[model samples]
Target chain A: MITLDHCHKYFHKGSVNEVYALNDICLQIREGDFITVIGSNGAGKSTLLNCIAGSFFPDSGTITINNHDVTKWPEYKRARFIARVFQDPLLGTCPSATIEQNLALAIKRGKRRGLGKGVKNSERDIFREKLGHLHLGLEERLLDRVGLLSGGQRQALTMLMATMIKPEVLLLDEHIAALDPKTANQILGLTSDIVGEQHLTTMMITHNMKHAIAFGNRLIMLHQGRIILDVDGTEKSKLTVDDLLQRFYTVQGEELSMDSMLLT
Target chain B: MTLYAALGAVEQGLVYGIMVIGVYLTFRILDFPDLTVDGSLPLGAAISAVAITGGINPYLSLVLAMGGGFCAGVATAVLNTKFKILHLLASILTMIALYSINIRIMGGPNIALLGTPTVFDAVSVLGVPPYLAGVVVFALFAILVAVIIIWFLSTELGQAILATGDNPQMITSLGVNTHTIIILGVGLSNALVALSGALVAQNQGAADVGMGIGTIIAGLASVIIGETVFGTASIARAFFAALLGSILYRLAIALALGVEFGHFSFNPSDLNLITALLVVSALIMPNIKKRLMQR
Candidate 1:
């Protein structure tokens, strides 16, 4: 579970160009709760995820994870409890390293680094078995350079990597936004399956309202750096993208016609 | 034409190969085109030679050499990462800075501890013959450093640094603190390069500030040659290729020197030209193979 209380984040604070990215946000997420966040460009959805992932420190707030006060923990120290996937496929892995090497790194994230053999023989079989979940034939290519992979393959591999160790919380920042539509669906399906299998508490920021409505037990809408709409369980399932868009307009007092989110 | 001469080539190549590995870390692994290698090489030699001359322990001298190079690498990284200076430009600034630092470390334009205890002194103490000592030192350092590199980059923090080079956003997203990783990578890289310089100074009996000139080119030549020769597959192979490329490059240089044995009484000054030609040949070899394969 994660909680953000009275969170405030400002970019370029005290400067003429300063903009508030997040304002007075309060949210509590329960264990195994899959929350999909929908927002337009600059809706501050990504900003909220960043704060939880410890990429940004909230200007004013307390963040608690699993009953621990983690508002002040630096990123590396906090990595043991969190896992994330980026939108850019290339951003997820070292392109020049072997698959096993990459997996070894993901397997060891947030641990003390030292000199020694990187991958043990036992870990190799473990990696192969895990690679089976992706269905990408990557198991046999454990020694191949990750650079040779297609974007979809890499994203799938990254998603698997992010959830490999099952951190306390999983943050997805428009992870499938860069993939082609077909690959996007496949990855989305994989995400649902993996989250269900592990019962991971997940927060996925999405521009696609359909995906926001279609996946997860809960949906939240953000506008102007504030969460304005929250729906869950039966109510979430009953709502369509049209209904969600209509609600955004009704609650925010503005037309929900952001082309970027709608087009997505 | 004989085994002795070939072994000599291997020794010389192996010594410079350490620089190649350092280059590999920055240029290949970290995905930064750092030209600071040119200056760090001599900076290592200068620090080691000066310390050895000042009666420092040989082991400590190597550490100081590594430290010197670490400083240079840090300067480059700080400039690049913090100041928003471009990578190439940042390296240039560090390289320039190191020139003066090396001079300051030496307390002169150059210094030689030709008869001092160096990285090679341990080998001689072990009763190895002087001529063979170079190769022994090279092999020992190569294995030790290679082991350290392979292990260091595999750890969770190390792996995150690797990920930093691959994708900074992921590292940031993962809370890896990319600025710290950048500094660490540079520090680790140039430390190896400086160690190479210390060994070189000990082998040759002195260090000159000018010794670092063209060092980056030589390291790149070795790396490209290694990639062409071994076809990079893993971290282990990338390292082995660096060593192999160094030996092969040395042999080519030796060949060039040998070719003019009698036709011209070539002096040591010819080394620069010979090195340049060998680099050109190595650069062309892979393209030639690719072209032939197409045919």
Candidate 2:
């Protein structure tokens, strides 16, 4: 579980171009909760996840993960309990490294890296078994550089890496946004499968409203650095794209004019 | 080239191969363009020469020299990582500071090791010919260092270092501190360069302050030439290529200086020019070959 207390984040503070990225936000992510976040551009969706991931500390706030206050920890230190899959497939894996090497790095997450062989003979079996499950034929190309994989395949691999060791929180920042529709659906299916199996506490940001409603048990809508809507359980299950848009219009007094969000 | 010159070139190549491997670790593996090796090479030589003249064991002095080089490398890494200076400028600052430090360590511009015992003296008792002793010893040390590096690269910590160089964001998300990894990598690289310097000083019977002037350039030339001649398909192969490239580079230099066509010959002072040309050709040859094949 993770909790944010009075979190506030700003960009270019005190300058004329200053913008309030996250403003006086407080939210608690419960155990086994898969929360789908939706917002238009500059809604602080990424900043909210970043503050929890310790990419940068909030201007003033406290974040606690699993009962430990990690607000001041550096990004690498906080990574022990946090796993992330970035929007850019290239950002989640090393292009020059082999598939097995990348998986080996994931396997040792949150653990001390010592003098043992990076890819042990025993771990190769595990990697093969896991890659086999993805059905991407990556099991046969463990030795091939990740650079040779397609964008969809890399994103799938990134998803696998993020969940290989089930962290306290898994953050996906538009992880499948770059892929085509079919690949995105496939990756989304894989994400749901893994999250359901592990009951992972996950926060996924998506631009598509249908996906925001289709996936995750809970949904939250952000506007102007504030969470204007938080629905869960039966309420989330009964909601549709129109209901969410109507609610947003009443709260913010403006139509959700992002065409991509409406159309998707 | 005469047989004597050929043998001497082989000896020099084997010794310098250690330095080339250090260059490969920084420039290729860590992707850190470190110039500290220029000064660390002389720092190693100075420490070893001074230690030997002061009555310490010759082999032990090599260790001391490596320690000195490690400190120099750490200084550069800290300046870059902790203080946020550009890596190139950080290494240059360390190199500049080390010039004065090397002189202070030696108490002069150079140290003579003509009479003192050396690592080569230990091999002379094996009934090896005096001319071949230096070659045998240098080859043994070079191979030993290469084997160690190859093994280290396959380890978990080594993998983290590789990932740190390949993609810092990916490794950091995997819970590894990239700053610590960089410091360790740069420090290890300079230690090897210093060890090579110590061996060179003993073999040449003196350690001069000016001996390190073109150290980084020659190391890079050897690395480039090795990668060109021998494909770097794997980590082990890349190291072997670097070592063999050093020997081949020395042979090429010897041949260039020895051969003459009725007053057309290269002078020793033209070594840097030759190295520059060799690197440029090696870098562009692959592209040229691809274009030729397309045509």
Candidate 3:
């Protein structure tokens, strides 16, 4: 379980550039819940994910994960239970590392890494099996550097890495936004497969309205650092891109702009 | 260059190979512009020289010198990671501070080891000529260090260090404490550098504070030249390239020192000029080759 209470985060506090990145936020993430988060630019979607990932501490709040108060925890400390996939493909994996080496690192996530061989002989078959599922011919190229792969392949690999250790919380921040439409759909399929197989508790931030509506069991929309619309189960299953836009228009009235809403 | 001069250059190259490997770890692998090596090199020389002068075993003094260099590296790492200082500025600060610390350790600007027993003397009982013995010992040390470093980099701990340099955020997200990795990586690099410095002091039969000035530049030049000439296809290859690069660099310097143009022979004072030219050529050679290939 992940919980955020009275979360208030301000950037450049007291300065002319001061803006509330997160405002009096209150949220509860149930176990095994796959939540899709949607928001416009500066809508606090990334900030919420960053806070939960322990990238930075919330200015004022209580963030608890699995009943442990992790508000004061550093990113590496929280990484034991949390995994993140960034929007930029380059941000997700080390380009200089080999494919097998990258997988080895992910396998050791939330565990102690010592002086052992990084890509153990025993893990080779497992890595090969996992990469085979991607159908990108990466299974045969385990020794190839991650930099040699295309951006879409990197994102797919990143998704696999995020769930390698069955993380307690998997945060995907616009992970597929950088890929082509076909690649994006393929990665989305892989994401669904991994999340299902592992039963992962996930929070995915996406700009595409269709993906936000299609993927997760629950949906939340953020507007100016506050959750404006939240729906789940039957209500979320019935939601359409137009309905979501209309909801936003009702909330912000004249401030709602189509440019901020990305359509597929 | 004479045959004897060429042999001497190879020996010096082997000793400095260790230092170039150290530079490669920080400048290339860790992506850190560390000037700490400038001071740590002399600090190692001072520590080894003082210990040897005090009747300690020369080999034991090398270990002590390495320890001193490790501590100096940790100081720089702390200044950058903990204090949130820019890495370049932090290393520069450590380098400047080490200048005073090195002098205090040596009790003077220089220490001559004339008539003092050294590691070379200890190894001379093999009945080999002095020049050949120096070459054999330094070569073995260089190869051993290269092998060990290559093996370590293939390990989990070493991969974490590479990842920390490649992308700190990604490594940190994978639950690796990047600050700790940075500290250990930089520390390990400086330790090797110091070991090289200790050997240098023994080879020269003296240690001087100014011996480390521009040491980082020399190391960088060797590394760049190695990558440009030999290529860095793999970690092991890169290691060998660094060693080979150092030897080639020394040979180039030795040959350049003897060059004459229109009755103006190159002076020993032109060492820096030679190094600068070598580095520039190395940097531009690949692009030149590519252009030539297009034609």
Top DockQ hit: 2
The best candidate in terms of lDDT = 2
Report the CA-based lDDT of candidate 3 relative to the real structure.
0.92
Runs of candidate 3 with Cα error greater than 4 angstroms are A254-264
User: Measured against the native two-chain assembly using Cα atoms, what DockQ does each of the candidate structures obtain, in the order listed?
Assistant: 0.35, 0.80, 0.78
- For candidate 3, the TM-score is 0.97
Clashing pairs in 1: A116-B151
What's the DockQ of model 3?
0.78
Error of 2 at A51 (Å): 1.8
Write the residue-wise lDDT of candidate 3 on B1-295 in tens digits. 8999999999989999999999999998999888899999988999999999999998899999999999999999999999999999999999999999998999989998888888887568878788788898899889999999999998889988888999899999999888998999899899998999899998898888988888888998999989988999988998899889999999999999977888898888889988999999999999999999999
TM-score, one value per model: 0.83, 0.96, 0.97
lDDT digits (tens) for residues A1-264 of candidate 3: 999999999999999999999998999999898999998899999999999999999999899998999999999999998999999999998898999999998898867878899899999999999999999999999999999999999999998888888888999999988889999899999999999888899999999999899988999999999998889999999999999999877777645455466441
What value does the lDDT take at residue A203 in candidate 3? 97
Query: Which ten-residue region of model 2 chain B has the weakest summed lDDT?
Result: B120-129
> Regarding DockQ, does 1 or 3 come out ahead?
3
C-alpha lDDT of residue B261 in model 1:
48
